[model samples]
Target: MAHGDITHIDIPVGDTQAARTFYSGLFGWDIAEVPGFEGYPMWRAPNQISGGGLAPRDASFTTPRSYVEVDSIDDTLAQVSSLGGKVLMGKSQISPTSWWAIFEDLDGNQLGLYEGVTSAE
Candidate 1:
């Protein structure tokens, strides 16, 4: 996905398996646990272009979070801070070439930033 695109959406659920089953059955999404992400089951819409994960709900992540693809998490977080937002989570590695971070906007709405090296690149 290109920068600023809505890359992924995380649905916080009390039960991962139940959420997976409900979503897959309801939307006909293909849900499966990826190799490296065992407990987190990823789901892809029938369109194949839209996808997200069923994340275990927690105090910090009580709501669904939308991840926007970004060119640089560091730069984005800096901008966020300058614009009256707060970083909830600093940049963290997702893989050798990928990273993610979470930030809350001025209104306290949380959003995520994702930086990754795609195969197309």
Candidate 2:
């Protein structure tokens, strides 16, 4: 992932299993339920390229969202606020070296920010 690059995407789905089957069967993607994620499934494209996840949609999250990689989640979020975007979700640690956050643009489109892996345990 590079700074300001679309690193991942999330597709909202009503049914995780159905989505998993449809995507995996249709595109030969490797979709599987990840533990500790409440059955949410992540997918890898057949060519082993782009990857994303299928998250159960709710009132707050009802559409597909693309995550843009950033060098610093905190700094990027500050910039987002300064630019008139609202932070829907604060920075959350996805792993020891990675973090993510969600925000809504001026037009109310949801987008995500991802801090790429770092040298951390």
Candidate 3:
């Protein structure tokens, strides 16, 4: 299960339009519905690059399991702290780039920033 990198992530919220508006207005992100995923908006990162998604908080909620792959979980955790975030879960191996953890930023926004790979990365 050595994930080369965190390919994508999904966040579940109760509202789509409000969620979209919040992200779009706050971060200037360009969000669009992923072609095949009905009601799921793929969130664009800064500079208009696709980063992840904002989806419905259904009973089958699954977006909480976001990921942040890293070369070294310890180092990444350190960086998270340096960047004003607190690790909620200590690093746990999911295999190489597949390891994971949770953290809260200074704003108390919970996010999982994984460092992994792409075919080209």
Candidate 4:
């Protein structure tokens, strides 16, 4: 995906199994737990292109968070700070090739940023 495109979303749920069943039954999404990600079950929509994880709900993660694809998390976080936004989380690794971060906008809406390198590269 290109920069600024929404690549992933995280839905906070109290019950992973219930949420998986509800989403899969309601939207025909394929929800499953991938290896190495035991508690976090990922769900892929019928379209197959759109997918995200169902994270355990917490005080800090009470709502859905959409992750925007970015070229660089460092640069984007800098821009966000310059624009009066606050970085809630610093860049964290998902894998060797990917990283994610979270920031709160001026309006206090939290959003996530994703930076990944595809194997094709």
Residue 16 in model 1: lDDT: 88
Tell me the tens digit of each residue's lDDT in model 2 across 1-121.
6798988889999988889889999989998766656677789897676888998899878888999999898999999999999999999998777889999999999899999673312
RMSD (Cα, Å) of model 4? 2.3
TM per candidate comes to 0.94, 0.89, 0.47, 0.95
| Per-residue lDDT over 24-105 for candidate 3, one digit per residue giving the tens place of the 0 to 100 score | 8998888888544568777768854447778689874645545555567678789889988898887765344445567777
Clash count per candidate: 0, 0, 8, 0
Report how far off residue 55 is in candidate 4 (Å): 0.2
Candidate 1 lands at a TM-score of 0.94
Residue-level lDDT of model 4, residues 81-119, one tens digit each, is 999999999999987898999999999999999999533
| Alpha-carbon shift of residue 8 in model 3 (angstroms) | 1.2
7 Cα displacement, candidate 2 (Å): 1.1
lDDT of 1 by residue, 1-121 (tens): 8889998999999998889889988999999888788888888999998988999999878999999999999999999999999999999998888899999999999999999963322
Using TM-score, rank the candidates from best to worst. 4, 1, 2, 3
Q: lDDT values of the candidates?
A: 0.91, 0.86, 0.69, 0.92
Better of 1 and 2 by TM-score: 1
Worst 10 residues of 4 by lDDT: 112-121
Off by over 4 Å in 2: 118-121
| Candidate number of the best lDDT | 4
